[model samples]
Target: MSDGPRLPGVEREADEDRIVCHVDADCFYASCERLREPELREEPLVVGMGYEEGETIGAVATASYEAREFGVESAQAISTALERLPRRAAFEDGTLDDPDLEREDTGYYRPVDMDYYESVAADVREILHDCAGVVREVSIDEAYLDVTERTAWEVADGFARHIRDRIRREVGVTVSVGVAPTMSAAKIASDFDKPDGLTVVEPGNVREFLAPLEVDLLHGVGPVTARELREMGLETAGDVAAADPEPLVERFGERGRELYDRARGEDDRRIEPKGDPKSFSRESAFAEPVEEPDPKYDLIETLADAVADRARREGALYRTIGVKAVTPPYDVNTRERSLPGPIDDRDLVDRIARDLFAEFEREPVRKLGVRVANLEFATADQTSLAGWESAVESDPEPDSESEPETGSERESGAEPGLESDPDPDPDSEPDPASGDRLVGQTSLADFS
Candidate 1:
């Protein structure tokens, strides 16, 4: 008996046997901005990575389609993007020779706000979960849904349209969807028409659907691979599909065989639902490296508070707390401590993270992070209440002759054996821009 279904001869009936949908948010970051400021919808907008005052170097996270028409692209340096699509200030000041012609064309710029984007992503995920039995969240802006049981080719287009419309109406952001019999084909179809596109490739058409596309358009085929494929006289996916698999395998190894299979629309991957996160962490990078121990310790406290708050929101208790310190020139040093049991104590997370970070106190640090791992979602009774009570009771009482210290004083003063660190001003806020680039440069393999 065969272990499973055979491949080459299966295509005759495979088209009608499966229903997979890939949904990609159209210009996700820019769309998120438009949701906040509707006026930006008509204007060219560029969401860059630097928004903090005096920060001049960063990359363009995403540019609206209008901005892209002027040669702005995601991952391009912010400086380069400004040259193509000058800032509003530049237009207002008549800095360019064609200032009158480009004055109204000045692009709106906003810093990346990850927390806000994540909140928007959560809303989109909720809608996806409602659409299919199994929905795989690939990233903040992409997902794949297995709707084989919900709809067939006959109504797949309508189903996809409903998803697109609902996302626009409910979430205030547009998504492009592709419905196909295979995951690989579905992903490609999703990008067929973008910025609110819906493309469907039914079972029998999968081969023809992928045939005329460039080899580089296929998932997993990068620039170098595309060039090599061209050298082998394979310019389009059709050429690779028809080429000898053994020679391709010999040339590119297992990846060559994968290329051939994907070229023929043979992906069998399933939609895997998103599960609980493995860990929770918060990291902060300094605008400039600092040698002072006080600033580093203060940043760690802030990171610990953020992580602990997230854990509490998720009703999770962690047994391990860790700290990451990135020194000058990008050397990462990490230390973790595992507790006797799981606990959700925020103060404990702060103290443990600080203790773990103590070794690098005097080092010039560029970034700091705090993380909690080994998570348990059970009730608080799982922790050692008796031990916690004993530890708290063991603290020495304040001297009657001394004045009581205020909360701010206690926070600023370090415990015995720990170096004193200045508390950061509560009014000062860090830039919310994240390190993640936007959806435009993401690979098709990411969705698969």
Candidate 2:
């Protein structure tokens, strides 16, 4: 790594030669089933919820390759999958309707064995961690590995095969591995050939490799977006890449530009692990920009209550309460107050949010939001105001007919940093200290 002088607020450049590897297990749940019951291998197996040897009531979780031949798919209704492929157990004992049903046409049905599958996934996860310097597990069965530090492009395919072989040999399950210079391309490459497949897209060949795929094949492009893209005459990745970007942007905002970029092999994202959320917030847009105080404050109070409830449910204590008010012409103005210490006080969250947003209550606001930040999560055993970290809110339940708090309940003296909070301006400085820890605060009100 170069010892370059790093400045605050400057974006870091993406490494062009970085190798990203996407590993996805082949029919993970069914594969796990086959691990214990070796007889289920290459057999038509269906793993789902509310499904037993004789009963069928819930949804399908996963269908093996053999089962999928008869139109079985994930998230499909259990009854629907059963209609296409009746349960083999019922057919064998002369129970299923229509006695002429062949044994080959029928399939095995198993309920979701999450605990066993998780154990199998843990073994696979260990192998992935050992193979790469950085791993981003997208789900239980698939992950992205940053192998740039581990292997070179010249032998990338062989390195990918080694990872695949390790999982299959050690864990008794097959995995498809895709290696590429970019994350988007790597993701597409992984699904190129399913069921124990491996594909590698070198540095310059990412675009060509992605060209022939359909629009929905790209990550984040779902059924609705793909249909819209099709209406715009962009049926394939190449179509989107070659079309005018102006129309695309008008249709889908920033995501349209992202689709165009990914179609052209222009993703700069690096592999990073998912982490705990920094803050929790909830917001709502008004039917029209309301200049009235009552409607605006009502929304703010509602949002504050919701945000606080979320924090309490998640076992988090917050030290900051904030409000967002979007004024006319799409300008987002925000204000927040930091407390002396973290507290799971719902009333306090509402109090501070309304106090901070008092200036914008009468202003023409198009949207309103409430947020709580500077969080400290507690364990399951610890939950209280003073000592325990895991305290659920102990507030009295409000009657359905009770009117909302309109700043009349607050006592004279206010919490420190809550009163006389400065608005964001060119000359003003943000409040950097809340309690023992540094608070990165932002207030957008008035210095005038």
Candidate 3:
């Protein structure tokens, strides 16, 4: 999130306005599958996690709209989804005619292929960069673009249509776009029509556009908050918008004010193009939590190499090397070692990450992560560690016995990286923090 577009020492107008567009790919993972095998376009598809060679259970990552009709949904256990939508193979030998098969539709299951989807996402992002002066990539399948200076409100719809058409023509995936005066409104409008839909809310219509919608449709209003709002007799955005500000503020603190403002279409957050990241991290989760040291160390080695490779590609260096371990039931612990100055030493990253992660060797670890932070972009130099003892003394290690926090326990914000889907795939597990991009203030619009 940026404070609008501003140069150094320049004052921004208090009433500055901009045209923001939120573009979201439709059922991205499923769409990618259809792209690969066009025969599956009409077939119900379910992409799952943990579906390897001898696994009875996995989790649903994404389901095609057809699959959703069968009550299959993202994040539901694979076993449950299978019960609702039987595998296509079940019907291959004339089993579809069986009276005992309650399901009317059979579905295909594919393991999540993150690398392939990422490659597709990169193509989409390239087009976004060309379409706007500033583009904020929220996740692999969604982004926000500031096109205020590029096009007027009258032509914004046409502008959006052009983008949608191009993506379909070039990338083979249809995208829904919402064009509005604010990011929140844009997000809602984009989802207002989905699967290659487009909706534009003119400047003055923001309030009316949001007023009749359910409160849960608003950004950051999750199930718990929606329930609370309904319990308070605030059923729609209109209710929140018209309620007394003081009571709402007192009840929800600063967030209440944000809710009120958003209901009234008052978001002023800018479309900040992701700049240099504060850190580089790579993570992988186990199919099942492992308590052994060798497997965990092997994962650490792979992650360290990945992060360091990314840093080298960006011509960046770091002074801190850190490792993260997530114990069973989602407890997260992080440890880091900081040097006096930044250095892009790959071996050093590997060694330090392993040293930091050594304490968690015997713990029931569900996930592992390696991060290099305190970044600087300068040429590498051989610097002596004469001051290493003092540096270590100044920055004491964290308590090794402390209970780790879950991913949700940490602060939420947009991190600089190619946003990956939160859902894990069997072959390529995602970082526990991977899906944070999809949940918070900057998430893709949730039409449902």
Candidate 4:
């Protein structure tokens, strides 16, 4: 029920500069699931594996902030989580699954349908491009937009609000937007609110706004780093800014200086559209050491689903599929197999992933990972454009019966009437914003 901040006019600037904004979909997987089935919106929804009441085989993928309020969090053991939140029965009874309802914890599992998640993520990406003048998608649920060319902050906030509404209306999800003078500031601002919230931080006010924030909130300050910073009496970002640099450097080396700059609201990273990556991986760690292979195979299938879904979502085809197993702290193993041609097939991915998992049959794996590597981000037509020309110019008349069908003929065809336009880059700039209203964007492509 939180309404975001209003747009403000620019006051002044030291020099001409571009404006950036970071937009992050809140509890993305949970939100996506909510969009898929609206009934779960008001419930304490959790998305993860090993929902078979008290099972330790699965980890949580995402939990709504509402769920988080009850101590549910990502990567936590599902068995322990049910003890904190009320257990809701699964859909087998045609009733909503709330973890707090049942005590015995029978059938507490919620399966991850990566195919459905990918479809929704793709739709979200489309919505992002529409709102951006320059969009740099950092992950499935987050993106940075440079809106300097077409609009400024005063007007762009309205645009962001409209996007938020449109996504809820058409896509059935909520997103948080953070606006600041720099990418670092903006990234932090977006997290200020939960689902469906927006916050704006102007350039001149960056230091004042960041001063009271926890040192852990700084971009690169992890829990370990935050603990160290606390030991140095640097509890808040402002403390880090005020601390002597010499002492910090003595303790943490070059990273210490980097932390100092970040704490002072100084990060200068740009949003660049890097296309599909060369590999995709999904991994899961058990709450306890897992020695059995059955649970390991189950996790591998889940990872396979994630890998295939990623390839299709990014319009990427992969030549190699691989698996990684971490037995504990020291032992790590990986294996891969190349394919005859680049493919986006889920069955084929599972086949290769499972084949690689066979190597670790005797190993006690605590964590299992599946990856699709050597990715190429071109449509079949784009990759084979030259081949098309060669067929047209063949000396003997090409087989008229062998003509390729139009894209629309495919079962999962592009939307109607929009087929003529090429798919815009997922990460494009936003509509222009005035200099003062511009916030920041995140450059990291991998999802945290």
Candidate 5:
């Protein structure tokens, strides 16, 4: 007889399939300002630290959507921002030469305040922790949650909305949430309809949803990578997904493989808490040292299966598979092999474990242990400059009035916040208005 199907809980879902939630606080720094100064709500507000009440010497830390409408943007020099969105104070105090500048034409400006922002972020973090079992806290303004165990595909939209609403009600800050089967898609989905938006990308529709997105929209595709992709005739994610991988690998190395996988919405990385154990193992003490290889091999298979199962249950991907042998007279020996990347293949685990144990197959064995190490857990972060909550007073809803932007419709889709790779020159500040996707810029939290 052959085994066909197993019952629920008998076999865990595939490692690639998961319900990942990406929560990103919209215009986080600017939103924190409105939380305390309610008067700033509905007004074009710019919070640029070091730019004093009447000075224009500092960089624009963040600009509200209202300010953005007037050509104001994050990282723009305050002097330039002032030229576009003249200060409301200047209009009120009649300091401008042109009396045509009405109060409505000007915007309020405030210095960046970090202490207050962090307290607000703390409240928001509390609610995210409660919604999912596994959360990777990426930064002060964004995080990734593995909600596979907490929810099903049928009602994932409601689950995501619930999170958005809870944060709005409790913390007084609006957040955009994206739900998808993979982390990369979830991150992109979260940004799909920003500013208190909620979008869910079902497993079946992941490919279709990602197909229309620009390569720049994909996570970790910085300006440099994007330029390279475009040069290779891969403008959108669909193009990259359909293109041959050999050239990509030749160009970007391992990252090329990663980029191709993400474009196809195939991220296998699981959301796991930081500081998790590096390895897991299963071992059994032999009643007596047996000289037979048949008995020793059987025990090795059992131990390998057990160790692999434990890692899977814990949502871990191990790159190294190892085995231990305790021979007669308690002499211990060990062997292991490391792979290029993390994986959750049980058969590979067994095969590798068995191969490693072959050296001791002929010797008498007292104890055998199977081990897996070099665990990889999902860790990820987000975009800033999204406006604060759209509807803070009443129940917030997705931006139903506005249509979500298709991949082609989005202008840049470059990540607005930190960069994926650390800057080689930490002290080298980026150009204030460089249009490229930048990293290591000053953040409100950094001020704190």
Candidate 6:
């Protein structure tokens, strides 16, 4: 009944269970920069914030292990990083800083040019598409592959190695991959060694692999959630696994059940593909916020093209257009417009996307996105707008102007037309620097 492979290194099973692999590009942003310039391969590199080297307001986008040696880390504010490493001046040269640009107090900081990174991410995704049977992209740097048909874990490691080498040679980035019986388990494994680590978690070893890790390592647990779990004396995945579900439910509500399932390595979530992503969005956070229209428009054009490509690949069409703009510190803004009906017109998507983007006008934006909301599978019966079923019962307009939904929610976790609910914000920008998880409220099958 199970599609899991029968091979060594994979968990022994008596029943149906799926073999899933989670592939995550290591130090995605920093790695992408290294690809652009081969010389920085082993150098101490940190990508985050704006050009200023000493400012901590902006978080670390990614730090090469070399940088990590000096305590530089992703998500840690850049200002705080200066205390650990020397500072360096920025290069607006539209090129990697000259090796000579180094300074004592100002360590090296690379401004995030998502346009370059997005292109590299696409190449990596292409490698995954070639290797996977059922591929589901989780982020620009992360994805889930169902390799059940083509390979087994005994050989999965080799597959991962080949993919890794290809990504490095062809895509110019290294990735860490984890293979396991379930998606959650594989995700945890992928993060184990990091920066080109290859970890495989067998089904039988799932519990063993997860037991010693802190509760926060579980997919859904965050700082706040972990803190609350700790108050109940639950520190490790094992602790949470052993706790009574009712009490957890009483304390954290729905999240409690989710925690319990993850603790027990019971994730039933599938590698559901978004038949075609209605919208593809990429946001670049800068230390110094940007309000310039020309520059922002350029970036929007780049992102719009990528989204169009994804829609084309998935055979999906869109009619609604939207965008999200985040102003420094923590202000999230969003806007959306609906089309006449489902249409696969990329130029139209681009034109409408840009039109919607005009609203941002000159607003300072630390992050920005482009979205096509009224989605319909391109392969579906082509019909006029009046004949199609709506994704939601209400109007197709985005329920509210908020940050894009989280990646998870965008695929199938968020409830349509119910943006204010507890569902995860799927469209929100994913922090490659930080493994931030956002799940929308919807069924996986809906998107697939």
Best by TM-score: 5
In model 5, which runs have C-alpha deviations exceeding 4 angstroms? Answer: 1-16, 53-56, 276-429, 432-448
Q: Which portions of model 2 miss their true places by more than 4 Å? A: 1-16, 52-57, 275-448
Which lDDT values do the candidates have, in the order given? 0.68, 0.69, 0.70, 0.61, 0.68, 0.63
- Model 5 error, position 284 (Å): 50
TM-score of each: 0.60, 0.59, 0.60, 0.58, 0.61, 0.58
Candidate 3 C-alpha lDDT tens digits along 19-130: 8998888878778777667788878988775444366656776788899899987666677777788888766756555666643477888876655565456557656755
Better of 3 and 5 by TM-score: 5
lDDT of 6 by residue, 276-362 (tens): 543444444445668888888887787677666666666677766666665543345667776557766556656656777776768
Where is model 4 more than 4 Å wrong at Cα?
A: 1-14, 90-109, 276-448
Task: Kindly list the per-residue Cα lDDT of model 1 for residues 211-256, writing each as its tens digit.
Answer: 9999877866656778889999999999999999998999888888
Q: lDDT of model 3 at residue 217?
A: 82
Assess the local accuracy of residue 185 in candidate 6 as a C-alpha lDDT between 0 and 100. 85
Full ranking by TM-score: 5, 3, 1, 2, 6, 4
Q: Across residues 1-448, which tens digit of lDDT does each residue of candidate 5 receive?
A: 1122222443344553578998887887678777656788989988774445565356776788888999987767777788898888878887777857777889988765544454455456546655777666655677788877666677779889999998887566788999998888898899899888999999888889988898887877867788889999999999999999999999988888988988988887767665565666666656777887898889888978877776776677776777767664434466777665567777777877787778678888766777788776653211111221222214322211112111100113322332221111122335545532222332222110
Model 6 alpha-carbon drift over 4 Å, by segment? 1-15, 53-57, 90-106, 277-448
Residue-pair clashes per prediction, in order, are: 1, 5, 1, 37, 2, 30
User: How many angstroms is residue 164 displaced in model 1 relative to the true structure, after the best TM-score fit?
Assistant: 0.8
* TM-score (C-alpha) between model 5 and the true structure: 0.61
Model 2, span 1-448: residue lDDT tens: 3222222343334554888998877887788778667788989988775555555446666789899899986656677788899988988888888867899999988766544555456557656765776667655676778877666777788889999998887667998888998877887788888889999999898888888999888765766788889999999999999989989999988778988998999998878755544566776667778998999888888988887887786688877677777665445566776665567877777776787788777789876877777778877453334542223234322211212111100000110111111111111221233111111211111100
* Worst-scoring 10-residue span by lDDT in model 5: 402-411
Q: Is candidate 3 or candidate 4 better by lDDT?
A: 3
